[model samples]
Target: MAYSIINCLQAAQDGVDIICLSITPNRRPSGIATFFNPIDMALLSAVKAGIFVVQAAGNTGPSPMSMSSFSPWIFTVGATSHDRVYSNSLCLGNNVTIPGVGLAPGTYENTMFKLIHARHALNKNTTVTDDMYIGECQDASKFSQDLVQGNLLICSYSVRFVLGLSTIQQALETAMNLSAVGVVFSMDLFVTAFQLNPVPMKMPGIIIPSANDSKILLQYYNSSLQIDGDSNKIVKFGAVASIGGGLEANYNNEAPKVVYYSARGPDPEDSLPHEADIMKPNLVAPGNFIWAAWSSVATDSVEFLGENFAMMSGTSMAAPHVAGLAALIKQQFPNFSPAAIGSALSTTASLYDNNGRPIMAQRSYPSIDQNLSPATPFDMGSGFVNATAALNPGLLFDSSYDDYMSFLCGINGSTPTVLNYTGQNCWTYNSTLYGPDLNLPSITIARLNQSRVVQRIIQNIAGNETYNVGWSAPYGTSMKVSPNYFSLASGERLVLSVIFNVTNNSSAASYGRIGLYGNQGHVVNIPVAVIFKIL
Candidate 1:
């Protein structure tokens, strides 16, 4: 039956162009080889037909021997974060009150000092004092008195025991008992740490840098040593310096290493032990922190709180991007087969990282052999997919549907019989009777392997003088024309078809549209709904 179908398709391949496939895996019982699934059979068939297939690497990582999107006949992609740097310090102003510690209205020398506010210590009504040492005060009565009356408390790290006793409940109790407004505790010199009230506090508290703490302490000490009248004076010191964004934005050009979270690989060695035998992850695409069109409903929903848009990190996001580019490639070279297109995309892709060096080791370090590196065949295949390169004439490979079926039958040791040719609804196709008359014109889209192929027929009721035919496919699906301009003799019928291979199975569930174009801008369209189901 497969042989008959192949013969029919070959006979009808007059004006056919390209074929593409999207590959995926099927579920199987444990301890069994998983290579004979339907999807795998379809992919092998598409490759034999010489079509292109694009695929996505699975999002399983942060460990050794992970199974990524692995398929020898398709292109795969990885993800990355945007090259943006975050600020380490938050800005503060003079109006921000530091009640426990006195700021003698003067700027002072910078020194490292830890910051501890009453809020962090779980105390509410504590005050600060220069003479009050940390970890030394034993009596709650004396400590409570010092905490309430003192403007600021200065103590050695040893007194932390007294402060540590101030639990949330105790702090609340102390707040009521002392009627103090605020507190400030100095952090240990070796380690800097602070915490805010788990619950809201009536008074505000902040964590300042050690340098700020030292400056405030020095100014307080200087003021206390001065005469009474000196308190009114405002001392000026050098301005505080900070790193700005404008200067740091150039960091990408300086250091373009892969982020810490991206997956790394060397085929067979890094891939799941079972996946070592397959041609894993045919290629790689930009999956890192990529920005794309998001659903308005999902973005605008209140569940996100105030954020309307969000950035996600995963291979899932990267899969659709490659799908969209496949559509573009299809549009440019309609005659290329899906396997050819896949090969073009992989072989023509750029193997170099942002640093202009071959991507060898996983993550972003350089290596000696481009192919032998752990990340070579697994983490990334042929580097990142280049849309423009795949569209170029030099990168095209053309194949037919018969070629694909032959490949599928070869892999599974199954011969295609009339019973094996499933119809649109998975019913058997009747070869005896011609199919129902398709309204206007219709195309049957099918996937034998990981590639999508269309079976289109043109009836010439009007004496065919080369009538124009045109259509369009969705964003991720591309189309190509074989024999772009064909001369159909009068009263003659022509059967034309093209196949689109799925490159990345990760995005197979996405909806795509196809557009057909012909002489004088004539156009027609067919919607392609790609589905990914786990068998």
Candidate 2:
């Protein structure tokens, strides 16, 4: 691994502009921490060589404490749904609506009914009442027996409420417990629920109307038997595509709206322990129920079940959409640094929701609709990422490899060890304290005494305009530029290489700067800082 890191660093130094490190692989713990480990050494070498690393925030979720590698240097991203709804299916008016059963205790009325029936029948002599606690179940078999005896069952729709089990599995378990010939559920809780026929039960499992469930439960308590016309009144609802269909309500089937499952945040209010200081999900993108590339043999899909390339929800899916967009920006602005690119993307995002109102931060229950004042830093870093705006940002900042190195070593003033970069190849240095030699944390770049090589590639837009490139190093170091003067024909490309030699041993830990000066006073500045071994 150490040797691989060295080789990778050399390649980067030789002008490999972007390196994507998949910190984690499916079915295994992420390798992200390895990159942060002091023992790895290669990570530091990479920073010294100057590389931008983007990482996934990890898939662990539904908990307040779960985090990815949680390092300041790495850009961590979480998942969100592409759109709010799942697959669209036509629901005939006569079709049964299954009120999801066995859901969490605080589930909607429709869900509560199914839970009551499932629990009552399984428990035999025990009668289910409206106030029965659904969360108290510890035995699936005992619950199943109760469900078999009762004509109805209720369950929660969310994975966390269901205790990490699939809804279908829970339904089947309920059916087996109850010896009843059929089942009924409510639709108020889950808009995405589907009906599966031949549900592997001696009795048929079906969803009913929420109104019907309420009526029957009220009458059953008052009279204790079947309510007339309950079974015949259930109907299925059709799926509608809302957002990505285009700015208008007209369904396009091409683009959908952002999904509800995506994680949202107001920037962290207080940097308390166990909480993030930075607000995330800077912008929303396609995530909910999105169909995308997947492992060839993975069984995560609903239709193919175990087949590769399936539809999934969560911010995880939304993150890659932005990553792909970032790739596009790099292609357009070859000279832009990663930090600049981040800035352009963040600053040019969209702020309004489909309904034209500002986005809200409320995330749960009846009070979930309360709206808070919106701030660019709070609701969104800038706005939802706009690829076009990023591609043609009016003003661009260019950063060289050295600037990033200073950032990694924590010598950068006042800013956290991890810095947020935006603009066109531009690196922005932020600090909490102000003043020269400011007690603020500062990032400084330095050169090593030994021979070092660095390469950079600058892509020309429109394949037009001939330009000349030059370089300079900080006062204490000397560098030799290869092909010091090169012509980049309109719609052409140029690659430059620079070799440096440090003045002395002290320079090994000294931070300095490097500049790439071009025509029209276009300049890219890079800070070079060396890592200090505390021991």
Candidate 3:
């Protein structure tokens, strides 16, 4: 934390415009909300000094309650993608071809080898170790060398996707150890990560992400002509390759959606009962398969040379895009505070994917239910970052150091006592001011079982005009904003009191959005999530 703080401070002191952090503390299982941990505290402190902090909402998503960087002061980012995928096609022995991805360049011509399925290789035993099945191509030494030698081996990839070459390489090493001519690994999930296309195929292999491809290959392996009155089954395979690549916003998908690995929110802080109803991941950007500059240092690790760029996927890639967008926002509004800048970006961001459907995120990592449900503000925060639209956001959800300080005093029994609390007494301010009432553009209730009013104030940065209120309440919850329609002059402010009345039918937690609209596509979406709990 100290090291991160020092670097951030130094950069700010050097007159750096923005701080985009792609790194985080790995020791902790999840991110600390605001001041509970050193890094978040340091970042919150830095934000107070007008240093815009754009961070990655860790890549542990598609899982419930897995999010980091929930601090309202920070602009947390999530990743999204399109249908565009890097294709590496492979030809089968039956003159059939299937799409695949590999790092090996060129072709591995007709070199026939008998196909061997992992199920057949397993020792004939009624009971076997778990690793015996999962470790087929993963655990090379376990294979029957005499039976596998010079044959094309088919194995299942151990995880969802290849996180790195080291994982796939391990499987390759196993194939090599068994004297197998090559291997055909199948992926359990579709990932937009890069596939290498290095020449002289590394261990002569190819990878397919579809389960159907595995079934097709298995069928062929089960077909063989009887020879010498002996019913025999043997499959022949040929020409294998590998490649590298990634993708985001193919702009061709039925709808734009958050990648499965992108972190989500309801702010993990909701783990505590009656805690702050704070939503996180302040924004979203195209992070998958992003092409950027890479290390040029010559190394034996990769198969190709003279390549100084690569297409990669992850939150790290997404955060920098936000950083650049933040820098651009700063360059235009040189006098705006960090919070104001963030508000502008969020307030004017885009909400619809290419298909005109609301932005959606995957339900869970291993889910195949393709009809993805709409993404809540928890997953998308404001929306997709729009550089031009952010230049002039009509209204700003502005807050100051004092307001945040008051917030610190109101969270679940105050943030952390060590946050310069000795200088200021928590009782001096509205100890009643909870975390969600920090003058943000959104409203939330960590636990809502009854009717209540959420106080909020919006500043009109645009010239005197009439802006109407519109909203979508979560199921079983009725909500309304007092003073629904308001007219404000330039540099004026308006207080819109929001009320949420829960219904007895309310069961599980619900999430929805409320939008304030003006002409010329000016829309401010406020997210509200009510944790249905027995009070």
Tell me the tens digit of each residue's lDDT in model 2 across 1-535.
5555666667567865444443432222233222233312344344334444444444433223234333333334444322233221111122322232211122122222222433333444344563254422323555545333433343323333223344444554545444433334333343332221111122333333243343443334334333347664213212111101111122323222322223332112212211232233334555445556556565443233334444555556556767677777777766555655554455445545555654333232222224233322222323455666566543332343444333333333313223322112213433221111111111222213365555544444333333343444544456666765555444454555656665444412333433444453333333333312221
Give Cα-based local distance difference scores for all models. Answer: 0.37, 0.38, 0.66
The CA lDDT at 283 in model 3 is 81
Worst 10 residues of 1 by lDDT: 433-442
Instruction: Quote each prediction's TM-score.
Output: 0.41, 0.46, 0.77
Q: Give the local distance difference test score of model 3.
A: 0.66
Off by over 4 Å in 1: 1-32, 35-54, 62-65, 72-74, 80-277, 293-304, 363-375, 393-535
Per-residue alpha-carbon lDDT of candidate 1 for residues 231-256, written as tens digits (9 for 90 to 100): 74323221121111111122353122
Looking at model 1, residue 129 earns an lDDT score of 50
Residue 94, candidate 2: how far off, in angstroms? 17
Candidate 3 per-residue lDDT over residues 115-225, each given as its tens digit: 676655554332236554453366765667876777777777544323433356566777788887777766543344332332224565677656666556656655542
Where model 2 places Cα greater than 4 Å from the true spot, the runs are 1-52, 56-84, 87-116, 120-167, 173-283, 293-304, 307-311, 365-367, 370-376, 408-535
Cα error, residue 314 of model 2, in Å, equals 2.9
Off by more than 4 A, model 3: 25-34, 91-99, 103-205, 210-219, 222-251, 267-269, 273-276, 298-306, 365-371, 412-416, 420-429, 532-535
lDDT rank order: 3, 2, 1
